[model samples]
Target: MAITDAGVMYGLLAVGAGLATGLAGIGAGVGEQGIGAAVVGVVAEEPGFLGKGLFLMLLPETLIIFGLAVSLILMFAWTPFAAFMQ
Candidate 1:
């Protein structure tokens, strides 16, 4: 069957959403890699420093959350997706 305009639009939207989330995750992972090694060394040397190390390690995770928010907004609040709902 031939694809309609809405189908094409929806496909593009899905790809955009996937890329947003995937890229964000990759960015966070890249950021965490270095922080993780440093945090491990700091914790090993001084257990009391674990709290600060943990906080630093978790900072990159916000990127993923923001990405998820963007993807959700694109899927649910974008004009084309809303139009298809009705």
Candidate 2:
């Protein structure tokens, strides 16, 4: 009895990739949402601080970008278990 490995490794990798992206997006979304809300609140009180608010709002986006880069690298460039399974 031989196990068909055609989809096993690929499926696992896909699931992992999905999880990585989902978690990263969730975290980034929450962080950026909070930042944006805070910036809005600050701006409401002091319209002159627009530059500072914009900077604060954008800072959390770096995490999402980094996560996307890591996911892309994992999906395309490297797969440790793929070698072992094959």
Candidate 3:
């Protein structure tokens, strides 16, 4: 069967969703790299600072979570996709 307009639109939406999640994960990884190294150095010097270092390291993870949320919204809740579904 030939591809319809809706199919093309849905494919683009899927690509957008994938990009959102992938880019967010990449950004988080890049952000965590620097913080991870610093955290390692701090924990090496002061074992007592481990908790604080861990908290700081985890902060970058929120970016990934936000990206996931956006992708979910795009796939399931965006008005165009919702309309296309009906």
Which stretches in model 3 have alpha-carbon errors above 4 Å?
A: 1-4
- Higher TM-score: candidate 1 or 3? 1
Tens-digit lDDT track of model 3 for 18-75: 9999999999999999999999999999999999999999899999998899999999
Candidate 2 lDDT over 1-86, as tens digits, reads 55458567667667777777778888888999988988899899999989989988877777777777767766776756545455
Q: lDDT winner among the candidates?
A: 3
Ranking by lDDT: 3, 1, 2
Rank by TM-score (best first) = 1, 3, 2
TM-score of 2: 0.74
**Among these predicted structures, which one has the highest TM-score?**
1
* Overall local distance difference test of candidate 3: 0.94
Residue 82's lDDT within candidate 1 is 89
Q: Estimate the overall C-alpha local distance difference test score of candidate 1.
A: 0.93
> Model 2: how far is 67 from its true place, Å?
1.6
Distance from true position, residue 16, model 3, in Å? 0.3
lDDT of 2: 0.76
